[model samples]
Target: MLVSTRLGAARQIADEAALALRPEHPEYFSAIPPPDPKALRSDVGGDLSQLFLLLALVCLFIGAVGIANTTLVSVMERTAEIELGRALGARGLHITVQFLAESTLLGLLGGLVGTSLGMVGVVVVCAVQKWTPVLATRAEFVAASSPCRNW
Candidate 1:
């Protein structure tokens, strides 16, 4: 609801600006009619942001399942090693902490390597396409400030 309201407000402001400029610049406004409010509303209703959000959620679930499976296998394979550690006075908490630390490090390293490879791939594709690789500074800044710790 709030998003719709804000979009409506923005549309109104743009319409007013167009009207103000119409007399001075007749060529630009001659063929452009004001956008229908209902049409605009309907168009903005199905935002791609929500789609990307859903995709992100699905990816997160898949990643979690994969990690869980990997951890389970690791635990199973290292049962004897863990038992030895326990026999040597390693507490259950200590084992849990060690596993958590290893997983965290794996995630971090994977992210870094993946990001580097992706960037190189993008650059190569752009070069092959004969397009200048332009980076949006504002977008980069927003991404840097986001809670998501992108590599």
Candidate 2:
């Protein structure tokens, strides 16, 4: 049987009611148990958090793969230039650093542009819907600056 009580006293009331009724109605109370709303809510929240974490991991993986592909294509297309640099007395480390620097700049640029567009999109939507924009400054800063952390 389900019984509704005040929000704050749900668990306490469930325990007290069960204790009070058990002696007079031992059979019914023995066959049924009260549900804990708090526990249920916590379990559902944990599941949703895990699901979202997995989704975020997948997205990061895809982004990394795309960046790697772009780097490989750039290297392949610039093979002649790389060979010329090597012939001009540029060491392997120099060539490597040059590519690394280029990649870092590209990542920084992409991060900044993506973050700006995303923020603008949010603001536009909020304005059209007559809703106030709410954003965490720290999160926005992290989103805009994460690419530079690789250096």
lDDT of each: 0.63, 0.72
What's the distance in Å from true for residue 9, model 1? 24
Off by over 4 Å in 1: 1-46, 135-151
* Every candidate's CA RMSD: 11.5, 6.9
Give the best candidate by lDDT.
Answer: 2
- Give lDDT: candidate 2, residue 146: 20
Over 38-85, each residue of candidate 2 has an lDDT whose tens digit, in order, gives 898799978877886787688667766877788899999999999999
RMSD of 2: 6.9
* Quality of model 2 by C-alpha lDDT: 0.72
Per-candidate total of colliding backbone pairs: 0, 0
Model 1 CA RMSD to the hidden true structure, in angstroms: 11.5
TM-score of 2: 0.66
TM-score of each: 0.56, 0.66
Model 1: per-residue Cα lDDT over 56-136, one tens digit each: 678668877777777788888999999999999999999999888877776666656755665566557767776665544
